[model samples]
Target chain A: MAKVPSELRYSKEHEWVKLEGATAVMGITDYAQAELGDVVYLNLPPKGTALVQSHKMGEIESVKAVSDLFAPVSGVVAEVNQAAIDSPELVNKDPFGGGWLVKATGIEPGELANLLTAAAYESFLEGLATSGH
Target chain B: MFLTPLNPLHRAAGARMVRFAGWEMPLQYTGILDEHRSVRRGAGIFDVSHMGRLEITGPQALDLLQSLCPTDVAALEDGQGQYTVLCHLTGGILDDCVVYRQGEGRFLLVCNASNRPKLISWIAGWQRRFPGACLIDRTEALGMLAVQGPAAPGLVAEALGTGLLALPRFHLGQGLFQGDPVLAARTGYTGEDGFEVMPAAAQAPALWRALTERGAAPCGLGARDTLRLEAALLLYGNDIDESRDPFSAGLGRLVNLDKGAFLGREPLARTKARGPAERLVGLRMVGREVARHAYPILESGHRVGAVTSGSYAPWLECNIALGYVEARLAEAGTVLQVDVRGRLAEAVVVPRPFYRRSAASGEAAPREPRAASAGA
Candidate 1:
């Protein structure tokens, strides 16, 4: 079973959003990193780019495969995680905390309705696990 | 789905399984990078039983093979093996293989898994000419394992016996495993000092377990690709295919054109005369973006060629690739660019074989420990 923290919100595409008032910190969920497997590169959007809710934000690549990263909420990119960008393996080792992808401000709180709670995401992941993917 | 004898073992070990060449096989256990480094720095074991193993025997066996292959099959003495290519009538490579002369008038041809069915039916058609020859498919009956790295020989000896290491490069020896005969060959795809042991299908799991128990990390096709790519060894479907001939693929040494009439002799001779238009070259990326298969190789803004195999070479600690560029731009140090997902990444032409072992298995020299040799 993958870790789905109770406090954080999750997206169906496997992104996690932790809203702090007007600012929101986001990263890939633990389930996302395990499925990605030993991330080697990231193609994150630069700061100042406006990210739309549940949209393609960037790409995460492993040695063998590539997957698109999705944004959980619509906001303007305030900060890019340089530490995670410098060391991609950190995403594999710590997907939630240090591996956070970006910080965004100018949050649209209405978008939070589409996000799932910890219990909902856990059940969603279980649904994926049993679908034989 | 086709599965190796060790399929259950791989599942038990929590390996990530993937489908390749019609067989379900492990893609990784721990991770690709971790297993790649394990094989380069220490020892790693690979279950390569999925590759086709054919047994050709009879009085006319050598003659039949000699007529089919561009390689000098008659040159191989008993117990020796040589890496060579099987060519089509157009001089395109049918598949790359290693032919081992097990004994008088007997040979074992190991080939890529994807091309096995094609080769079997194709070779059977030629068997009509050599009424004295026989071909037997031994892929299911036998299982092959490659134990590779600098520490491989020592560990193999410790687990099996010291006599196994006495065999020279490209030579075969029989090792005793629980009173049964296990065929061991001093040949490998990983460009390291190692042995490829062929055991009966029933005994494969035991052999793999014994090696892993003795400290050989179980690796998968993921790492196997990286290791072989680092050495610039051709992957049949990726690097050399029926659409491409051996000479253009940088396998001219395997083609003994003057030896005699063979399958692709005439076309190969003409190709030798005119020279290849596109030559395969090694590319080292200046950045981390990997140049994946079919990505266009760019000289300027125009497309010059395409990358065949590209990856972050775990051993070299840099991104490396093999691709066919225009012959004019194949020279070393020529700057080229690979369009990595629409981003042009800078790359330069370097020599083939981006990695080489200090004492590779190709050398005929005995590599027993200095301590053991000093006493003797």
Candidate 2:
């Protein structure tokens, strides 16, 4: 029942990325949001900060616990989503849309090779469920 | 994992079950924040049958309890209960318990689920000296439910009648449910005015149904934990354990050394003369960062202490934590830092019980209400 829009590519760490030309939009996936329960706070890098592929960028905290946020691609941060920062529950409500965490540009297009397409991500989720995650 | 008597009922209510202290109990029915706020603002019912319930009876029951617990159990008249701790010979804590004097020669001890097995063996060892006393594990035979919040007393009164409503806080009384007697005690871990009721295991489903129908939200362990933390009630394994003593854990007020030769009396008396070197203090995060367990507490750049328990207090809407620090640094207003996953997050020593309510006969907790002002 987890939403996986076919247009976006996903990271194994549960981050999703949508490439529009040289620009990329990123946010946590539906599976990650459901696992996090209620999102309460966030600590993402400010604009102009550099990000490394698969590296920890910041933290996401819920009422229950805290988790590290990993970057899906190597790029210079262009803008951090101000709306999601103001109201974290938006991530729990809409992980794919208004909950987008970052917008960055200048990433190599070949980064898609390291990310999974919608079809691949769905199977990965299914594998996790069968293994009792 | 072990199952409570109401396991099936919890599943039927769509509660998300999780393993805690060897039992598969509901982590949440709807959500932890929702359930936590319900108990703080109104009423919530929790199926706490997984917690241990032990009964002791005999002419020497009082004598045995007095020798085992640090609290002055001899002073508890019938129908009264006191929050106390079981300690080791070296003054280390064994477990925290609420000892209730339910009858002339009978007593009931409620303990944490994780410490149940250890407590049974510990009490048995002490029972050998009290020849006339007997210990019975009633945890499996009875089902326990905690109905808590501001409206709890009214809900309980309506469902079970005026018998339990008439009892004051920390008192016990008897009431009828379907013509069967159930013991109701005015005690709870959530710092809310409420009653913890003990019914026959077979009647658990009916009791749960009746309470929920009467407007008590079916809560789970997740909210129960958050509520107790906001009240600053120590979790046995997470906060206090065999390695820490009551004095160091900020429970010295419950120790009555002059009462007589209890389990930790000798060492506790010595500790009373010379204050504990480390004291448990409350910590308020200055921002969104959380200081989880084992995270180092820093004074300047050196490690001073570590967090025991930390989380976002839903009702209070702030991040709070409990940790042990040097006696000199335990005072409120002392600023410190927590190494939250390698990043230094500013924190300050604040007063305990991050939240309080009228249900427990306490003033509103005078702690940081907002993380923004915690730094100053």
Candidate 2, B1-376: lDDT as tens digits: 7899999998888787888999999988888888998998889999999989999999999999999998999888788889999999999999998998877779999999999999999999999899889999999999999999988877877777665655766867777789877888878989888888888999988988999998999998889888998999998878888888898899999998678889978888888889988888899999978777788899999888889999888888888899988888999999999998889999999988788675454222222221111000
Q: What is the interface RMSD of each candidate, in Å?
A: 1.0, 1.1
Runs of candidate 2 exceeding 4 Å displacement = B359-376
Q: Report, for every candidate in turn, its global Cα lDDT versus the true structure.
A: 0.88, 0.87
Say what the interface RMSD of candidate 2 is: 1.1
Residues B102-154 of candidate 1: C-alpha lDDT, one tens digit per residue: 88889999999999999999889999999899999999998999999888987
Q: What's the DockQ for every one of the candidates? A: 0.76, 0.66
Task: Please give, as one word, the docking class of candidate 2.
Answer: medium
Per-residue alpha-carbon lDDT of candidate 1 for residues A1-133, written as tens digits (9 for 90 to 100): 6889999999999999998878999999999888777788888999999999988998888887778888899999999999988899999888888999999999988888889999999999999989865
The residue ranges of model 1 lying beyond 4 angstroms of the native Cα positions read B360-376
| Deviation in Å, model 2, residue B279 alpha carbon | 0.4
List of clashing residue pairs for candidate 1: none
